[model samples]
Target chain A: MKLKEIAHSRTGDKGNISNISLIVYDQKNYDLILEKVTPERVKAWFSESVFGEVIRYELPNLGALNFVMYDALSGGVTRSLSVDKHGKSFSSALLEMEI
Target chain B: MKKIRIGAGAGYGGDRIEPAIELMEKGDLNYIIFECLAERTIAIAQEEKLKDPTKGYNGLLEYRMRKVLPLCKEKGIKVVTNMGAANPESAVRVILNLAEELNIKGLKVAAVLGDDISQSIENYMHLEVLELKNPLESIREKIVSANVYLGIEGIVEALENGADIVVTGRCADPALVLAPLVHEFGWSESQLDLRGCGILAGHLLECAGQITGGYFADPGYKEVPDLWKLGFPIAEVSETGDILIEKVDGSGGLITTATCTEQLLYEIHDPSTYITPDGIADYTAITMEQVAKDKVCIKGGKGRVRPETLKVSIGYKDSFIGEGEMSYGGSNALAKAQLAAEIIRNRLPIIGCEVDELRIEYVGFNSLYGTKIGEVLNREHTLGEVRLRVSGRTKTRAMAQMIANEVEALYTNGPSGGGGAMQSVKEVVAIGSIFIPRSDIHVNITYKEV
Candidate 1:
């Protein structure tokens, strides 16, 4: 199943950085997601868009994980020529990740 | 102390006003806060301020204030907002006159000033930019506005002085909601733990309808009921920082644990060290439970002392962005779009129009993710229509307009069945973050009564 089936996400941006918070619907899937969804995996998943390092923060208490990507947003909102400058749709794109 | 009901009037500058009206009328709220400034909006507002000294606040300030002031007067609810954008004093004057026009008596409005550091930005030029790690002098000439992200000090002072409405330029978005909590509950500046919870409530409620399921509906998967009539959120916060998140009864959307969890992480970077003027809030320290229908209880968030330096957003003229789009439908739509993109790519340099950065993609196919990622995701489906989008950033507005003109020319010059051509040129107001000593920023509250 895709990550969207078991989990959901929200994308937030600041400067050239973008952060996505991935929350699982069930706590039972937390361990699996935590093990599979690494910083490296997420950075690679957003291959063309994310050029910077990806950092992950764990929130097992709430059955969620946060992935922060530096040098994202192409050149941040004002500078990025992207149609989705803030990378708001990056949340839905991350949901395409297979689990 | 009694539990205070605070409702988020708006999330951003151009958000829906009807929901805010509903929140004010239906929700028995003590306070309604409208957080209007975004990262780049203050700079845009600054640009307007340069033209007209009396302007530069939120464009919808008059409309929003006119609609809500009557309700606030009727219900005896106080108002707080950052709608003052680049000029809060002028905004306060506007509000004061508005109150007089509406015949609302004895309305005390306060303007919280001192965030605009553009005049004295040179004094801090020796400081290094936080994100770029470069000296502040790097882009010194391009600096248009520099406003610090203030905390609750100004608003607290305004409330303490019995101001019914508090207007500010740029403070932390959460401060609009947090200041009232502090003033009503009498949380001292030293109470980091209690203030942390208050800030937490501010964070959750800052985005208005978002917590009440504005952005969480996925349909057939994560469904939100009556999303079109989505109700704004109301935070019932106790003195100890215990919060019950709910909406007015019969309002649309919901407040489940799922919705709350999503908002908890929205726009947040480090869950453990989310910085604010008050303290470093540990967002992960809290747990959310669905205590009732359309209600969630948030408890237990920890915090440490705030950083001595405050965060300042420096807005500068970045560049001009030009985007042009043309849709191709009927047979061979994808092929025609590909051809159109190729022609524009080959035609640009030949036309002697250069840009700093360029991206040409097929909408409905690969505009979001690149062609490679789109292929991996949408390989099974054959596209019936493709919208060719050509976007570029350039130093000059004319060059940006030419970039858009090139796409519009494709109607007769390149591909057939090209329709609905849209072109837009935008002057980018880029923002950068820097820090200044808390002492350097002197927040003041100026009051005006009607």
Candidate 2:
């Protein structure tokens, strides 16, 4: 199953760092997410797009995981030549991650 | 417990004024705040201010004031905003003039200044906080504007002095909401938890309708009603720092646990330490309860001491961006768009244009998803119509313009049935951050009455 099936995500960018929150639709899926959605797995999933390290911060109470991707955006919006300047659609890309 | 109701009127500059007008008329708000400045926008506003001293505030400042100030004055709802982007003085003056034009009496406005550090940025030793890894001194020649992120103290001071409206330049976004809580409740710096609650409330409402389902609507699953009529958020903050987030009756949008959760984590890197100029708020244990439809109760915000250094947004001229797009339809549209992209990529270097970076995308198929999903999707599906988009960055506008010109030439030179051609060349004002000792920036507030 794809992560999007059980989760909804949103992406926010500050400077070159891209933070994507993978929030579960149901709290019951939290354990599943914890086991499969490791930072190493996410880093590997986005290896082609993200150049830097990936750090995941957990919020079990909220049933969410925040993935802060360093150097993910070609550059920050102001300097990047990419069309999706703010990386608004990056969350959709993260949701493509299969579990 | 004594409570104050504050409404987030505008999220960003150029945000719709109708929702704000709706808030002032019906929200029963004691204060309405407009977080109009973004990180890099003030730098661009500074450019305008330098050209004409009286013209640096948000472009729609007067229009917004004209529409809402009359109702706000009648309702006794105080207004607070960072619409004073580069020139608080000028923005304050504009409001005063508008009040007079509307025949509103005793309209008091406070302008908070001293955030602009362009004059003294060169004096400090600072490293670039974002991209373009260079010392502040090295980028001195290209620096356009530098402003520090001030806190709630100045806003508190203005309210203490009986300001009807407070205008600021680059104060932290949350400060716009937190200041009122501090002023109304008399919360001290030692009351970290109370302040943190207020900060969290401000963050939730700072983006106006964001927490109220504007950004949460997903057609079938997370359905939000009457989204076009979506109401901006209002926070009822109790003295103890508890808040009930809601929207006015008849206003569109839903306030739910899911919407609040999405916004709570929006742009936040760490839940435990969400830093603001006021204090470091810990949102890790925060809880949300759906009190009713379109209403949510928020609590559990803890705070720590403020950062010793202040973050400064520095803007400098980076490069010019040239973009061009042409749409294609009929048989093999996607294939035609791909060819058009290749033509622009190959043509740029041939014309002696030294592009620092370049991107060619087929918009209909995979402009946003990149190669990961795009490659797999392209193999299975075919696009009926596609737009070829070519964007590049270069030092000179002339060179950047060449990239767009080459794309437009493809319409007449090759790719059959190309239509809706568009091209643009824009100068990029790149923004980076640097931290300066808090003592280095001095904040002051002055009042003007009409």
Candidate 3:
């Protein structure tokens, strides 16, 4: 129901890479969500839209999932012109997941 | 024979330059360049312009300018800067007036305009040629500040037009040095490698003699001799696109391989794809050697083709944020602060109030730099403070104001007893960029007599 709960539920301390907590809301099946929301499972869930490495972890304390996406941003945060730092249109892809 | 020295100071926020001024007086530097504009600064400038059009220009920080300009004028050193944000013409007008008041003669002022592209944003979006994926849909209604970052060509044009002081808005940091190179050498824009070299030169000097020492010097902050009188920065650009990063005589800060390498790596995310308005420069391609004491020679900087389109900054109204602070006096202050934040979050939503962002920071308990987290357990409370910050769009006024009121009331329930409350939440405006085709945006370089 809350963002912090979502973040806390999906946190993991992996080697060389730490899982950053993120919250994706589910308006319909908020209660039906399962416990085992691994990064690999989350990546497979959004496999169609995601281009980079999507690693997910479920935080038992907060009941949330955290994901660390690698190179998800086109050109790594900068476009052809280096002055701007806005990444490409990937938010819709990010917002479509069922959490 | 005395060397013609130049010092460039990176400008950001109004700070005193007594040390730099003192150096200029003693060193006899010929030119000084000051740079100050980050992406965040651009956002803030746009927000201000939306609130009041006349107040957005950064050059209006005349307090800092007043202190340095008169000193430079007296010492006969030329200065170039991009402090003119939003309205450069108005900024120049003020500076010229200041020149007159100072009784400084021959103050050649030049203005670089035509970068503002707010009107043509719609036309560019409709074309659909360059895909702007997740554009800020909400900002379309009230876009405030929009300025394209120009290149060194404008700076060169200003210098060729006989203007001594070139004031610009949102120009690339390296353009400060490249402009002088273009003016002196007449290098064409198509010379990508040469332009890249010039940009590299600008990047080196843009920090205002920073390469020589300011921030890259030894630990314990050993005082450079007569640093109180340190110069800005000046580049001796050669016809071959070679630049000598040097400072005025008798100035402090060492220019060595270590210092130069440190400065080159500053704020750089990717070494290979270092982008500038001019072109993409390869930092690895650069070769440096300490040829002399306090002198670093940089060469072999490679550049690639520049992108066709220009990026424009767009800002829109977002939300109102309210913050309140109270000093936690009793023991276990950190626990009290955390509990207070938890209480606010849990109770705010019950009263028809939603928060977008809630941050509870213990200033003394945590380190501000990098991502290091400090332990917040079992610490004696000598002097501690807890600040609560919350942001939200829906809770614009009444709801956001109530959050502030609640924070103050926490003194009875909060751990620190009754300390005080401060209002911190205000409107949150979001800023993004919309690239327009080269044809839509026009860059006009004009020369006017002063």
Best by DockQ: 1
lDDT of all predictions, in order shown?
A: 0.90, 0.87, 0.57
Q: Candidate 3 at A48: error in angstroms?
A: 26
- CAPRI band for model 2: medium
lDDT of 1 by residue, B1-450 (tens): 589999999998999998889989989999999999989999999999999999999999999999999998899899999999999999998888888999998789999999998889989888888766888999899999999999999999999999999999999988888899999989887888888898899999988888998888898788888988889999999988889999999989999988888888888888988899878888877988899999999999777898899999999888888889999987599999999999988988998888899998888888887776788777888788899999998999998999899999998998888999999998988888898999998888888988
Per-candidate fnat, comma-separated: 0.72, 0.59, 0.00
Q: What TM-score does model 3 achieve against the real structure?
A: 0.71
Runs of candidate 3 with Cα error greater than 4 angstroms are: A1-99, B1-5, B23-28, B42-55, B59-61, B64-76, B126-133, B136-138, B209-231, B246-256, B329-331, B365-372, B375-398, B417-421, B446-450
Q: How would the docking of model 1 be graded?
A: medium
Q: How high is the lDDT of residue B380 in model 1?
A: 85
Where is the poorest 10-residue window by lDDT in model 3 chain B? B369-378
Task: Kindly indicate the candidate among 1 and 3 with the higher lDDT.
Answer: 1
**Candidate 2, what DockQ?**
0.70
Q: Give the 10-residue window scoring lowest on summed lDDT in candidate 2 chain B.
A: B123-132
Expressed as tens digits, the lDDT of each residue in A48-84 for candidate 2 is 5678999899989889999888888778878877778
lDDT of 2 at B448: 98
User: How high is each candidate's interface RMSD, in Å?
Assistant: 1.2, 1.3, 17.3
Q: Which candidate is the best by TM-score?
A: 1
Arranged by lDDT with the best first, the candidates are 1, 2, 3
